[model samples]
Target: MTADHKIHKKDPHYQQAKRERYRARSAYKLLEIQKKFEIFKRAFYILDLGCAPGSWLQVSKKFAEDNLTKYKDQYYHRDHYVILGVDIKKVSKIENVQFLQNDFTKPEFHTHLESYFQTKIDLILSDASINKTGNNFSDHLRQINLCLKILELAEAHLKFKGSLVMKIFQGADFKKMFEKAKSVFRILKAFKPQSSKKTSNEIYLVGLQKK
Candidate 1:
């Protein structure tokens, strides 16, 4: 086997993801977040930004299906649950989720989103990150900028009382992004899931109840 494959095989999360049939180990990050916060609770219309390799999409589909089954008797139209994923990179198909390949930072992306789901989204997730350039500071800045863009999209597209979970690299401007999120959300918290690499500075900003 290749050296990288060997390394990945030894990683516990990678092995677990294989066993669970998830596309990537990153699925565990969302799983841990859901376990802690129940962010998917009552989320019918969902959007995933920068969703390539679709591990998060898998978790979302499972959660939405479970929610539908649990509350099957409550709603007459139980057939609809909108889960859309957007990425600059082309993602392979997932059975129940929709994938759109477009630059989410562009204005035209909104037009595409509007065409798919008429109502505001109940939850917005962004696992968006810049390709690491080996310079931590520069990488952090780029990631924070990406997070801010996701926040802007959330502010415009999220339904009132909706939730947003976005990944951001902790850096000097981390507090600035936190403050921005605070202004837009009623409740905001920074979380690092155990599945995240211990050496990585990435953290998820969970924003609840859009105001």
Candidate 2:
């Protein structure tokens, strides 16, 4: 009925997500990533950063719960699913997701994560970005800096052979960031899901089988 609703209804992914009970259209992006990379395979603990609106957390919770059932008999990956979501903005609660609304760049965030998960993360997902100033270059640079910080967290918290997916903007230093990820991950690839807005420079960088 509202103009915003009409505009959102124009997007097939948005409509599909609504019908499927997902929190947002962005859910499709993670679904596509999972399809391509199998990043959820054998993952017991997942950390979702910049998880406001909680769609990725929804997807992660589903896959993590499934993994609990699927890997029940396995020697590992059978731990009760631990899915954590972090954001600077508050998110409505999702069942089974433990959320910490805080600035991840700060030290307290890492301390909370270490206390919560207890062990190294099996997969880390970050769709987080800096608040856009509507200036593309400036926003891109800030996002790149955030992506770099994510890599630092990966270094400290992710287990060997773990997987990661992060959203980044393409601009100056994009390749530099990509190569930097390459140094830490054995397999790294950039993916732009069909669900992403055509005009957006946002892309998902997937790091699999971390060394």
Candidate 3:
């Protein structure tokens, strides 16, 4: 292996992801969430915002594959399931996923999303984060803003019973964000996957069955 690969392999999650053919170590985070909540139980159309390096897309595909028998009766009539990813930066191709390279903060991006799906989505996952500037407070505020944007998109595009999982830094604005999530979703939860680095303040907010 090359030196870079050697270094990456030393990380347990990275090694496991390599062995499992996942795109990145972060795949395990979504997998853990699935294990705890069964978020993909009946999902047919899914979206991944800020999916770069595409690990979450990999996890979504794997979940669909593994649960095919269970969800087939509910979704099999569809000619094809939709798994779309959007990011500001280009992502390497992954089979069965359509990716759009666009900044999601722009209003026009919603048009692209609606045109592609042509229907409300069943699940939306966002692991988007602002570049950390070493100032925790500023970083937290930026991430909170990003989470609110994701919530706006979800409100506009998610089906009534659909779900969302998004990452946000836990700081001053977290409770406000959580309350906003509660207003939009019948069930709201905060989760931190074991795969997440212990030192990181990032937590996932899950909103289920949008109101």
After superposition, the stretches of candidate 3 with alpha carbons farther than 4 Å from their true spots are: 1-10, 66-68, 72-77
TM-score per candidate, chains pooled: 0.95, 0.95, 0.92
Q: For candidate 3, what is the TM-score?
A: 0.92
RMSD of each: 1.6, 1.4, 2.3
Give lDDT tens digits, candidate 3, residues 1-211: 7998886767899889889988889999998888887888777689999999999998898776655555446444344578999998999999888999999999898999889999999899998889999999999999998988999999999999889999999999899999999999999999999999888999999898899
Per-residue alpha-carbon lDDT of candidate 2 for residues 1-211, written as tens digits (9 for 90 to 100): 9998898989999999989999899999999999999999998799998999999999998888888778655476475789999988999999878998888888667798899999999999999878899999899999999998999999889999999999999998899999999999999999999889998999999999899
Write candidate 1's Cα lDDT for 164-206 as tens digits. 9999999999999999999999999999999999989999999
Angstrom error at residue 177, model 1: 0.4
Q: How many backbone clashes can be found in candidate 3?
A: 0
**Prediction 3 global C-alpha lDDT:** 0.89
The 10 consecutive residues of candidate 2 with the worst lDDT sum are 71-80
Against the true structure, candidate 1 reaches a TM-score of 0.95
